[model samples]
Target: MAFSATARDSAVAEMNITPLVDVMLVLLVIFMVSAPLLTKTVDAALPQIVPPSLDTIKPLQMQLDVGDDGSYRLDGRLLTQSEVGERLAEAAISDPRAVLRVHASSGADYQQVVTALAEARNRGIANLSVQH
Candidate 1:
């Protein structure tokens, strides 16, 4: 049956929101009651250890200097690009504890410095430092 378009009859065509409100209220109460039970805590008594200092012990380190003239040096001795990777790999293999410090000149190419850093990493140097 079609409802008349009169204003009084048009009220029947509107939605009844009472059931929706009741469901929302029920969900809110359920969440409020269960919220506390969802959280859990555990007591932990863990021991702490102090880390070693960098300035304390100075080990024998290997230095790689990249000059603005595109030259490489391993401990002040000049080397070509091809020799850098091979020599660094050997040094890393000989003493894994050896730290490799890269000193790039101010005018040195950014890509060259990055490439040298990558070469050290690729050679499996564990401790690498850069001096810009």
Candidate 2:
């Protein structure tokens, strides 16, 4: 073989990726080991026993509908504004825990629906819902 002085002192231009690969593998393992610990759930003691009440009265559910012609109907029966108020008052008196659902027809006025809901609130109905 011929002796070449040019190759003796010149460094190789190739990159050494072994250390990079080793560092990446170490980081991957570290993350994998700590991931499960980061996801560990809190140990809590939630209440499992609930007491039953014998005198609990079931809440009454009533539906009120607003007609397309701006009329008010209670439980599918047509009624005037005063009558609706009276019926709501009666329901409130009979069962203050009554739930009222106000339904409005597609052609019904928004004011009518709002008025019905307001009336239910005035009658001391805390639970009320509006439907279409």
Candidate 3:
């Protein structure tokens, strides 16, 4: 077979990279324009956060004790049955999250302990415990 010199001259073997260069230049311009916009900031006022007070941070705790002689004591202070109820109600109002722990003596009358517990429950004492 005879080779034709004209056919070889007409054929182009080089890779075309014009579209690739055009895309890279467009991407460079886009990134350059967006880089400054990314660093731009707007001035605005942010709300200040107030630290929590001691009262809210610490839970309120109270202890009630029933003596064997049918007497009630709150925080080591002797109080009447009606006064116990009043104190519990005040505590509930002062801090609804207050915790009450009832401690009964070994010989304490069951009825007295029950009465105290019932009063505490009625006063909205959600956190309560009875100890013997």
Q: What is the lDDT of residue 83 in candidate 3?
A: 99
* C-alpha local distance difference test of each model: 0.87, 0.89, 0.93
Candidate 1 vs candidate 3, TM-score winner:
3
Candidate that would win on TM-score: 2
Candidate 3 global CA lDDT score? 0.93
Among all windows of 10 consecutive residues in model 2, the one with the lowest summed lDDT is 48-57
**What would the per-residue lDDT of candidate 3 be over residues 8-102, giving only the tens digit for each residue?**
86676567899999999999999999999999899999997776685368668999999999999999999999999999999999989889999
TM-score against native, each model: 0.55, 0.59, 0.58
1-132 per-residue lDDT for model 2 (tens digits)? 986777864656567999999999999999999999999899999987655663465799988989999998899899999899999999999988899999899999999888888888998888998889
How many residue pairs clash (N, CA or C atoms closer than 3 angstroms) in each of the candidate models, in the order given?
Answer: 0, 0, 0
Q: Put down candidate 1 lDDT per residue, 12-101, tens digits, no spaces.
A: 779999999999999999999999988967789998765678546665589999999888888999988779999988888887777999
What candidate 1 gets wrong by more than 4 Å, as runs, is: 1-60
